[model samples]
Target: MNIGIDIEEIKRFQKLLKDKNFIELVFSRDEIEYCSSKKKNAVQHFAVRFAGKEAVWKAINKSKKLVITDISFKNSVLGKPEVYIKGKKASYIDISFSHNKTTVVAVAVSSK
Candidate 1:
C-alpha cells in the first residue's frame, strides 16, 4: 500500500473555488453531497474534497488513470468517510480528512 497526504489553508481553497473552472476540476457530486451533509458550509466541504483529491493523486502517482473527480467519499452507516474510485478496479483506497480554523488536511492510502 502507498499513502499520501496534503494540507492547505482554508483561505487558499476558498480562492481556488472562486474559479468555477477550478471547482469543476476537483469535485464529484457524491463527494460534494457527503461533505455538505457533514458541514454546513459548502466552501469548507469543498476544501476537504480538494485535499482528498490531492491526497489520492499523490498516493496513486503515475500508475493510475484516475482524475480528480474519479475519487470520491461517501458516508458509511457509521458515518465514516469511505473512499472509492469511479471507474477503475483497484485494491483499496482509504481517506481521512480534518479541518481547523484556518487549514484543511487529508490523507489517503491505496494498495494493489
Candidate 2:
C-alpha cells in the first residue's frame, strides 16, 4: 500500500483553464463537462481533481511521470470522490479532496 497527498491554490488553475488545449490534455471529457457545468468555482473544481489525480499518480508510480488525463475521478452516490486509473492495474485507489476559498487539498491511498 502507498499514500500520497497534494495541495494547490484555487487561483493556480485559473491560468491552466485558459488554454483550450491544456484543458483537453489534462482532463477527461467528462471532467471538463462537469466543471463547465458549475456556475461558480469551475476552475477550483478542476484544480481539486487535478490535485487528487496527481496524488494518486505519485503514490502509484513513485518514479514514472503521470499524464493527468490518465487518471479519472467521479463522485460517489454519497458525494465522495473516487479514483480510476486508465490502462493500469486492478488495484484500488481511494481519494479525497477538501477545499476552502483559496486552496484545495487531496490525498490518495492505494491498496493492492
Candidate 3:
C-alpha cells in the first residue's frame, strides 16, 4: 500500500483559473464541469480536486507520461469522492478531500 497527501491554497487556483490552457492540462472535462457547477465555490472545488490529483499521482508513482488529466473523480450519491484513472474507475485507489476557507487538502491510499 502506498499513501500520498497534498495541500494547497484555494486562492492559488482562483488565480490559475484564468489560464484556460492550464485548466485543460490539469483537469478532465468531467472535473471541470463538476467544479464549475459549484459556481460561488468553484475555486475551492478546483483546488481540492487539483490536490486530489496530485496525491493520487504520488500514490501511484507512475511514469512521467501520466498526466494530471489521467486522474479524475466523480462524487457518489452521498457526496463522497470516487477516483477514476484513464477513464475507468480505479477501485484500488481510495481518496478523500478536505478544505477550509483558505486551503484544501487531499490524501490517497493505493493498494496496488
Any idea what lDDT model 2 has? 0.82
Cα lDDT for residue 18, candidate 2 = 88
Q: Using Cα atoms with residue i matched to residue i, what is each candidate's TM-score against the true structure?
A: 0.80, 0.88, 0.93
- Model 1, span 20-49: residue lDDT tens: 777656677666565556555767778877
Sort the candidates on lDDT, descending order: 3, 2, 1
Index of the highest-TM-score prediction: 3
On residues 10-92, what C-alpha lDDT tens digit does candidate 3 reach at each position? 88888899999999988888899999999999999999999999999999976435678889999888989999989989999
lDDT of each: 0.76, 0.82, 0.91
Worst 10 residues of 1 by lDDT: 82-91
Please report, as a residue range, the 10-residue window in candidate 2 with the lowest summed lDDT.
82-91
Q: What TM-score would you give candidate 3 relative to the actual structure?
A: 0.93
TM-score of 2: 0.88
Model 1 misplaced stretches (Cα beyond 4 Å) = 36-40, 87-91
Candidate 2 stretches greater than 4 Å from native: 63-66, 87-91
